[model samples]
Target: GAGVSQSPSNKVTEKGKDVELRCDPISGHTALYWYRQSLGQGLEFLIYFQGNSAPDKSGLPSDRFSAERTGGSVSTLTIQRTQQEDSAVYLCASSLAPGGNEKLFFGSGTQLSVL
Candidate 1:
């Protein structure tokens, strides 16, 4: 992909449904990040993967939320037993380096709605 790519731009589901969001980063970017934006939460950092190892999983709200990166390129975020509170725009971003402030290329995001 020429840039960060997120799939299923919009997802609507009933409460208790599970959802998976995908992100394919730029070919050479080694730092991938997951964030969620909602009117109530603002922008929250969910997780970050450097290469295939995740050094930062602290941002995830609970055990129900998890993410993983494979082959140092693509990443997936899974939300189990969706709640209306979990509805938000899930965003993915990548940077050339492993730092919070590094310039990033962001995907459009997946808007997940739980009713």
Candidate 2:
């Protein structure tokens, strides 16, 4: 892809249902990140993958939330047993590399609605 791309720009799911959000980062980017933005709140870092290293999952809110990057390109964020509090815009960003002052390209985001 030309830039960071996310699928299912809008998703509505019932509480307790599981959902998967996909992201395709720029061709050469080695750093992919996932964030969540809730109403009236700031963007909260969820997870990040850097090259072949183990992903940083410390930012994930709970065990129900997990993300994985495949072949250093596409990434998927999965939320299990969704809750009302999970309703928010899930944003994906990618950078050239990690631990450096590099510019990050972000996708439009996937608005998840947990009803």
Query: Considering every candidate listed, which one attains the maximal lDDT?
Result: 1
Candidate 1 residue-wise lDDT, 10-114, digit = tens: 999999999999999999999999999998778899999999999999899999999999999999999999999998999999999987579989999999999
Candidate 1 error regions (>4 Å) = none
Model 2 Cα lDDT, one tens digit per residue, 4-85: 9999999999999999999999999999999999888999998889974545888899999988777988999999999999
The backbone clash count of each candidate, in order, is 0, 0
User: After superposition, which runs of candidate 2 have C-alpha atoms over 4 Å from their true positions?
Assistant: none
The window of 10 residues in a row where model 1 has the poorest summed lDDT is 96-105
What's the lDDT for residue 104 in model 2?
Answer: 88
Assess the local accuracy of residue 69 in candidate 2 as a C-alpha lDDT between 0 and 100: 79
lDDT of each: 0.94, 0.92
Model 1's alpha-carbon lDDT is: 0.94
